[model samples]
Target: MDPFEYLEDLEDDRTKRFIESSNAQVEKRLGQKAKEVFPSLVEKLREERPIQLLVLGNTQAILYYGDETSLEISGRRIKMESRDHVIHSLERVWNSQLVRIGVGIRGSDEGYSLLIDPNGEVVGKIEGLVNQFFYQEGKLCYVKEYRREKSPDGVEPPVERIFCGDEMFPFYPGRGEWLSVTAEEKTTALLKGRGWSEATLYVGEWPELREEDSGKISSVHIVRGRVYYLKGNDVMMDGKRLFSSNHPVEDMKVNEKFVVLNVIKDYRSSLSAFTPSGEPLWEYRGEHVYSFDLMGEDVYALETSFTTSHSLLRIRDGKPYPLRVGRREEMEVKDVYVKGDVLLHGFLLTRGKPKGVIVYGYGGFSVPVLPFSSAIFQELVKRGYSVLVTNLRGGSENGEEWHRQGMLRNKLNVFRDFSTFLSLVKSLGGRTVAMGGSNGGLLVGATMNMYPDLVDCGIIGYPVLDMLKFHKFLAGMYWTFEYGNPEGDDRDFLLSYSPYHNLKEGLPPTFVYTGLNDDRVHPMHALKYTAKSRSLGNDVMLLVNLRSGHNASTPESRAEEMAYVMAFIEECVAHSSSSLHTFTIKK
Candidate 1:
C-alpha cells in the first residue's frame, strides 16, 4: 500500500466536482457583482469626501495630496523641518488628544539621535547612537546602540547586553540579571533582582537546519522558575538536558503543572508534555500538529490538512474532542486564537460572485489577521466594501500539506480557490478588489494576468513578478520549498503562471508598489511589470517609495501608503463614462 493512497482515495468525485463548479461560479459572479457594487462604493467615496495626504520626509519635508503638492504648513496642514544635517530618518505621528511627532535624525559628527514633541514643538532630545525608540507608559524609551570592533570578516562582533528599565547595560556584571547577546556568549551569572533569580535559567545556541529558520533563537520559555531554550535539537532546561535528538523542537509552552513541547521531524510533528522534574506527562503523534495555544487547563491542538482539513481539537480530561464553531461546508476555519468564547477565528469561505467581495490571501509564513490586512480591510469595509479572506492552499493554515498544495506545480490551486471565493461573493451581491503582498503579491499578479476579468481592481505590493529570474537574487534562493527549484521540471509550471511572462493586452487596472531599499523582493519586479503593462496598453500605476523596505515599517510612511491606496481605489470604483488615462512607464 502506498503512503499517499489514502489522500488519493479521499479526493473523491464530490470534492473534484465541487471545485470545478466553484471555479465557474466565481467567473460569472465576479463579472456581475463588480459591475453592480463598484458604483455604490465609488459614490460613497465621492459623497463622504475625505482629504488624502501623502507625507514623505527625507532631506526635505514633502507633502503630496492628489495633484496639489506643498511644503509649507498652513491652517489645517502640519509641517516639521529637521534641524540636523542628517536626512529625516524616521517619522511617526501619534494622533491622540494632541498629535505627537517622533523623529530620528542622524548627524555626521553627533551620530544618531531622536527628538520628540507635540505638533512639532521640541519636547526632548536624546543624544546617542540609537536605531529606534518607542513611547512606553508616558515616557519615551530608546533602543540604545553600542559600537563594537568588527570581526576579521568585517562582521560586527557580538557583545553581552542587559535591559534594566530604560537603561541598557552593555556589560552588566550583576547576578541573575543578564542576557546572552552573542551566539558564543553564555550567561556567566544570574543576578539577584525582581522575580526568581535562583531558578535554573539555561541559555545556548540553536543551529537551524532548514532554510526557513530565522537563524534566531529556536525556542524560549520559562517553566515555573526555570528557563528552557532549544539549542539545535537539544532542550536545555535550567542547564540540564531534557530532550536531545536530531529532530527539532519547533514550539514549547509551559504552565505551573507541565511543559508542552511540539517536536518536528520532516513532515510529522508530535506533542509531548512533561513535569519540571523531567517526568513524562503525555505524548501524541500526528501530521502537522504544529501550532497550539493554551486556554486555562485545556490545550487547543490544530491539525494540518492531511486526512482532515484544518481541524481544531480540544485536549481536556486527557482526551481530544473535535471542536466545531461553524459548518465545514459553509466555511473552513483555518485558525482559531481564543480569548475566551470570542475566538479570533480566521477562515475561508466560497460563495457565488455578485457580492463585490474582495478575496484576500496572505504572503510569507502565513500570519492571519495581520495588522496591515486588518487595518486596510476595516477601512475598506467602513467605506462600503464587503471583504473575504481566502486561507488559500499555500499558506500555513492547513500545516505543511496545505502549504505544499499551493506551491510549485500545484500553486495554481490557490488562484482557483480565490476565484471560487470571489464567485461565491458575487452570487451574494459583492465585488472584489484582490490584494496581496510579497509572495502573495505574486499570487495576485498571476491571478490578474490569468483571470483578467475576475477582479475589478488588483493591488500587488512588492510582488515577485518574474518567477524565471527570482532565484537570481539573494533572498530568492530561500523560496525553493514554496516555489520549487525553477531549474527542475517545476520551471515549466512556473513559466506557465509567472505574472511577468503572462502579461497580455487586456486586464483590470492594476496598482503596483515597492520600495527602493527592499532587500527582500527587488524593486525591479515592479519596474519591469510597469513597463510591460504600459507596452501592452493596460492601465497601471507604479508607486515606488524612494526609501523604505518591503512594507513601510514606519507609521507615517505606512499611513501615507494606505492613504494612496484608498485614493486609488476611490478613483477606480467611481462610475464614469470616460476612461482614465494610462500612466506612462518611467524608464
Candidate 2:
C-alpha cells in the first residue's frame, strides 16, 4: 500500500540509483562550500576531546578520552587504546579489579562488553548487545539481547535475557518493559513494568518487597545492600523516607558515605548532598550538572553551560572549588509562554546580530537540551547565524511529567511546543532554520510539515518519517511506548502528522540526510521521504553517507557532513525573505 515501499529494499537497483543521484546532486551544489569550511570547522570541534570521566575513589579518576578517529584510556593501571572502534560506555566491575568497556565500530551494529583486568588484557567479552551490568562478588551479571529468527512476516524479535555469571534468566518484553541490576553483596534485579510506575524488586532468588512497595520508583541504587530510590519527590531508603523535596528529584547517586541528588525545577538542575539516613549536608545551586560521583567526603561533578563547555569541580561541605573549566561562546536562556499556564524554556547562543537563526530541538526520550556543543554552533556563529536550543515538553527539562506530557497520545504537545518557539523566532524577522537529528529529526520533520510557514529550511537527520510502518523497521518497535502503536487507536493521530504521508508541495527547502550504516533508524526513512518529496517538486535534498551510522561517526566525517548541512542552511537563508537581524524581544 506504500507508494515508495520498494525503497526499503536498499539493495535494489532503483534504491542504489536513488541514493547515488541524490548524493551527486548534493555534492555538485554544496561540495565546494563544505570543502572550504572543513579545515576550520573540524579544528574548532576538536578543541574539546570527547572524554568520559569515572571517579575511582579519593582523588583518582579514570578518564576515557577519544575523538572520531581514535580512543584512549588513562588513569588506569595499564594503557588501553582503540583505533577501529568507538567507546560506547565505561563501567567498573564492583569488588573486582576489572572494568567493563562497551565498544563498537563506527557504523556497524555489532558491539561487545569487554571486561578488562588491571593489566589491560581483555579478560572477558560478552557479545550480543551486552549492557546494564552489575557485579556481585567477583562475577559480572548483565542484561543482553540476542537476535532471534525471523517470523513468518519477516520480522526478527530479539530474545532478551538476564545473564548472571553462568546462569541465564528469561526476560519478558512486556510493552517494552526493561530490567535493571544492581548489587553489593547479592545481585538484585528490578523489573520495571509498563508505564515505569510499578517495579518488582528481586534480591537473589526471592522478592524483596510487600504489595505496598510496588509504587512509582524512578531510579534505584543499592548502597550497603539497601535500596535507595526516588519516589514522588521523596528520597527513600529501604521503605523509609529520608528527605522530601518541593521539586522533583531528576536523578540520584548513592555511595557508602553520601547520596547526591540532582533536582530540577523550571529546567534548571541543582545538586544537593545528604547522609545515607536523609540528613541534609549542603547544596550546590549552579549550572546543570552533566555527571557526578561521590568520593570520600567530596563530590566531583561536571557542569556545563553556554559560556562553560566543561567545568570539573570538587565540592566539600557544599563549597565548590573548580578543578578544570572550558570556556565557550556566550549563551542566554529564554522563556516563552505557549499557553497562559505553559511556559516553555530554551537556550540561545549568539554573537552580535545574526542574519539567520538555527532553531535546533530534540524534545523526546527524556533527554534535556543542554547548550554544551561548541563546534557546530561555533561555525554557525562565525557565519553570522545564531543557534537556539529548545527544551521542549517531551524532554526531561522540566521533569518526568514534562516527558509524559509530550509522548504517546500527548505527542502533539511536542510539535506545538516547537511551532510556538519558531513562531516567536520568525516574528523577530530573521530567516529561521529548524534542525534536529534522531528523535529530534522526527520533531522537525513533523513540525515542518504542520507549520511550514514558521520554518524557512528544515534539516532532518536519521529521522523516523514513516510513522505508520516505523515499527516494522529495526529497533523501531522498541519505541512504541514513546510513540504510540501505529496499528491501534494512535494510528489516526500518527497518520495525521506522519511526515512521509504529510509531504505536500510548497514545503520549505529541506535537507534530509542519513547513513547507509544506520541500522538503528532505517535509511529508507530518508530515501523514501526524499524520493517522494522530490517527485512532488519540493525543495528537498538528500545525502546518504556510505561510511557513517546514526552514532560513532569520526570527527572528520562529521565535520564534512555538517559542512554540507551548513552550506544548505546558508543557501536557504540567503534565499528567504526575512531580513531584520537580531531577535526582537517582546516587551
Which is the leading candidate under TM-score? Answer: 2
TM-scores of all models?
0.48, 0.90
Per-residue lDDT of model 1, residues 255-281, tens digit only: 667667776533356677777556777
Find the candidate with the highest lDDT and give its number: 2
lDDT of 2 by residue, 1-587 (tens): 77788899989998999899999999999998888888877775555432454554433334433343322334334333544465656666655656677766665465677876655567787876677676654556777654434422333553346666886644444424555655555536364544433455444422242332555576677766677777757888777788887776777888888888988755667888888777888899876776777777878787776666677888888898998876565545444344312777776677767788888898887777754655777778777788887778888766678888888888888999888878877777878899999888899989988998999999999899899988777767667778888999999999998989998999999999998878778999999899899889998999998877876656676777888998898788888655645554432
Total clashing pairs for each candidate = 30, 1
Worst 10 residues of 1 by lDDT: 190-199
lDDT for predicted candidate 2 compared with the true structure: 0.73
Q: Clashes in model 2: which pairs?
A: 68-555
Error of 2 at 54 (Å): 2.4
Q: Relative to the unseen true structure, what is the C-alpha lDDT of residue 433 in candidate 2, on a scale of 0 to 100?
A: 91
In order, candidate lDDTs are 0.48, 0.73
